[model samples]
Target: MIDPAILEPLADDAWPARERKRLGGWRLNASSGYSMRINACWPLAAPDRDVEAAIDAVEAWYAARGLPPRFKLTDGVLAPADLAGQLAARGYREGKDTLVMVGATDGEGDPLVRLSFSADETFETVFTASAGDPEDGRERIEALGRMPPPACFARLDVDGAPAAIGVAALGGGFAGVFGMRTVPAHRRKGLARRVLLTLLSEARRQGVERAWLQVEADNAPAIALYAAEGFQPAYCYRYWSR
Candidate 1:
C-alpha cells in the first residue's frame, strides 16, 4: 500500500512531456527524455490477465515511440514478488539505483534563497552552471515548462550569480523535491543546505507536512546531506532497462 500511496505525489507532479497511458493495472509513461519516472513503466498492480502480453505491449509502445524500454520498480511491498524474475527473463538489466527519502517540512527558510513560480533565467543559469552543459538544462526546462500548479523553484546567488538551485512541487500533502544542484566551483559550500532548508520552509508555507526526494544510491554526498537535514530513506527503486 505504501507503494501506491507514495505514487500520489509522483502522479500529481506531471510534466509536459508526459504521455501517460494505462495498461490494465499498470501505468505506462513515455516522456521522451525529460525524466526517467515519466519514461518508465510504473508496474503498480498484479495483473489478472495476460502479464507477458502486457509486458510486450509496453515494450512495443516504447519501441514505437523510440524510447528505451524501462521499468521503475521499488523494493519490498511496492514491487510484485515475481517482477524481478519476469524482467530478467526479458533481458532487462538494472540501472540507476535510487533511494526515496522522506522528511518533515518544518525547517526554517534562509533569506539568501530566492523562490520563483516558473522557470526563469536565473533558474536556467544555475542549472546550466551545475549540469555542465546547456542541453541538459534546456531539456529539464522543457520538462518543467508543463509542471503543474503549486510548484516552486529556489535559487541562491553568490557573488551576484546563482550558485545553488532546487525545485519543489506540493501535491497530496507531500512536497516532492528534486533537481537540487550547486555549481562546481560552489560545491562543498553550504549553499545547497540553505536552498534545501529554504525549500522545506516553502513547502510548509504551501501546507505540505512531508517532504520527499529521490537521489541516486551512489550519491554519498547528497545522501549524507539529506540525512543531516532529517530526511530518511523510505524505499528503494531501480530502473530495469531492456
Candidate 2:
C-alpha cells in the first residue's frame, strides 16, 4: 500500500493543473471553475474526531469559486474505512471507478512487438476516426496544450490505414498513458492490443520501469486485455461529482 503522504507530492508533480491547498490538516485541491482531484484528506486528529469543519471548508471553497468539489479515493488509501461514509453524507458520490494497472519492464516475453509508429496522414485519420465526437476530441487535445512534444502524439497504422492512437506523458518514473483509442472499424482485430503493447515497448525503451493507466471499472474487455498482458490493478479510484 502506498502511503498517503506520497499523494501530496505526487499530485503536485503529476497533476499540476489543480491548485493544492492544505486546510485543517487535510489537503484539498481545486482548479477554479474547472475540476479538483482530491489528493489526500485524512484527519489530522483521531478518527473519532469530527471532520465536519474541514469538510465544510472544502465545500465552501468550491462554492465560492462556483466549481464542483470532487474527490478520488484510491484503494490504497488508509482512511477510506473512516472517511468514505462521511464524504457520502456531504453529497459526494462515487463517480467512474477506474483500475490503475501497472506493468513492469523486466518481466519476460518478446520485447519487440510488431507495431509501427509513424507521423503521416494515417495519424490524423486514426485520431479522427476513433473520436466519438469531434468537438470533445478537439477539446481534449486543447486541454493537453501544455504537454511537451515527442510524448504528446503517436499513432499506429495497420495495413496502410490508421488503426489506433495513443497519447502519453512521462511522470514520476511512470508513463501516464492516456487517450488510447481504436477506430470502430478496427475494433476486435487485435489492433488495440497491438497499439498498447507498442506503447509499453516504447515506454520501456525510454527507461520507464513501470507504466500506469486507468480504465473504467465497467470496461471488462479492456480490463481483460490488460490483465492478459501482465498488467495488474495496483489500486482503484472513483470520481465524485454533484
Candidate 3:
C-alpha cells in the first residue's frame, strides 16, 4: 500500500499555491480562495505549538487575507488523531471528502494526444470552457502554469477541436495528475481516458514509478475510470471549515 504520509507532500508540491507557510508540520496555503486544496490548511502532522494555538493562528492568518479558516484533514493513521474532534469543537464542519488513488505507471500513450512541456492556449481554452466556476477555473489554470519542471500538459482533439486535457507534475519517482477536463459535447467519448493514459505514458518515460490523483468521493464515474486504470484508494481527506 502507498503510504499517505509519503504521498501527501508530493501531491501538495505538484499543485503549488500562491501563498504558503508552515506551523511545524502543518501546511498553510492560500490563493484565490476558490480551490479548497490551495486555500485550506493541510494538517498532515502535529504542529509546533499547542493544537488550539495553532488553530488560532490559522484562523488569524486567513482572516488577514480576507478568507475563511479551513483545514484539510487526511483520514489515516499518520494524521493527528484528535485534530478532527478539536476542529469540531471549534465549530469547523467537515466538507468535501476526497479520495487519493495510486496506480502503476507502465503503459503506452496515445500518439494522437499532444503533450507539451507547458500549458498551451488550446489546453487553457478547453479547461476554462469545461469548468463550471470561472474563478475556480482561473485559479487552477494559474496553478498549472506555476508547476515546476518535469511536468507536461496533455491535450486531445477531435474533428480539429479540443476535446479533453490533463496535466502531470512529476518528481521523486511519482506522478500527480491534475486538471482533467473534457468539453461538454465530448462527454463519454473516452477522451479523458486517453489524456490520462498519455500522461502516464510520459511519466513512465521520465522514470516515474507510481501515479496518484485526488477525486471527490461522490464522483462515481471518475472513480470507475481510475479503477479501470489500476488505481486503488490510498487514502481520503476532508476539508474542515467553520
Candidate 4:
C-alpha cells in the first residue's frame, strides 16, 4: 500500500497559494475553483475521533470565505471507517472518480519513437500549435517557461508538425507528470504515449525514482496507456462541487 505521506510535499510544490488551508486535516484549494484538480480536500493525516471536528473546521473556514465546503477522499483515505458516509451526510455530493497512477523509473517499456525536448522557443511552438486557443497557448507557454529548467518538457513532432506536448516537475524524490496535451488532428496516433515515455525518461535523468500522475476515471484510453507502462492505481479520489 502506498503511504499517504507521499503527498505531503504537494502542498508547497504542486498546489498554489490560492489554495486555502483549513483545520482538521482538510484543505480548500481554491486555485482552480471549478477544476477538479484544484478544488478538493485532502486528508493528509489519518482521521480519528476528531474527524468530525476537523470537518466542522473546514466547513466553517469555507463559510467564512463565502465558499461552499468541498471535500475529496481517495482510496488511500477511504479505508478510514465511515469517512465517505460522513461527508455525504454533510451534503458533499460525489463527483467524477479519478485514478492516482504511480510508477518507478528503474525500468522503461520502450523508447519514444520521435520525441525531443528543447528550450522555450521549441516548447512555445508546440504549445501554440496544439492548443485550441492561440492566446491561451501563449499564456501557458509563458507560465511554463518561468518555471525552473529542471521542469522538463517534451514535444512529439510528426512530419515536422508539433503533435503533442508533455511536462514533468521534479521535486521531493518524485517527478510529477502533468500538462499533457495532444493536438486534435493527431489523436490516437500514439503521440500521447510517446510524450509520456519521454517524460519518464526525463524523470529518470533527474534522479527521480518515483513518478505519479492523475487521470479521470472515465479516460479509459489514458488509464490503459498508463497501465501498459507499468503504472498502477495506487489510489482514487473524487471531487464534489456545490
- Return the TM-score for each candidate structure: 0.91, 0.71, 0.97, 0.75
**For each candidate, what is the lDDT?**
0.78, 0.58, 0.89, 0.66
Check candidate 3 and list the clashing pairs.
none
What clash pairs does model 2 have? none
Q: Order the candidate numbers by lDDT, best to worst.
A: 3, 1, 4, 2
Best to worst by TM-score, what's the order? 3, 1, 4, 2
- What TM-score should be assigned to candidate 3? 0.97
lDDT of 4 by residue, 1-242 (tens): 46655653352355343545645345555442334444456665554438787777767766776667777766555334577787778776788897778888644424543434434576677666665677555545544554444677777777887778777777777777777888789998887887788778767876888888888989999999889888998777776555
lDDT of 1 by residue, 100-166 (tens): 8888996789987888888787787766656566665566666777778788899998998888899
Model 3's alpha-carbon lDDT is: 0.89
Q: On a 0 to 100 scale, what is the lDDT of residue 218 in model 1?
A: 96
Predict model 4's lDDT versus the native: 0.66
Candidate number with greatest lDDT: 3
Compare the candidates by TM-score and give the number of the best one.
3
Enumerate clash totals for all models, in the order shown.
Answer: 0, 0, 0, 0
For candidate 4, report its TM-score: 0.75
Per the 3 Å backbone cut-off, how many clashing residue pairs does candidate 4 have? 0
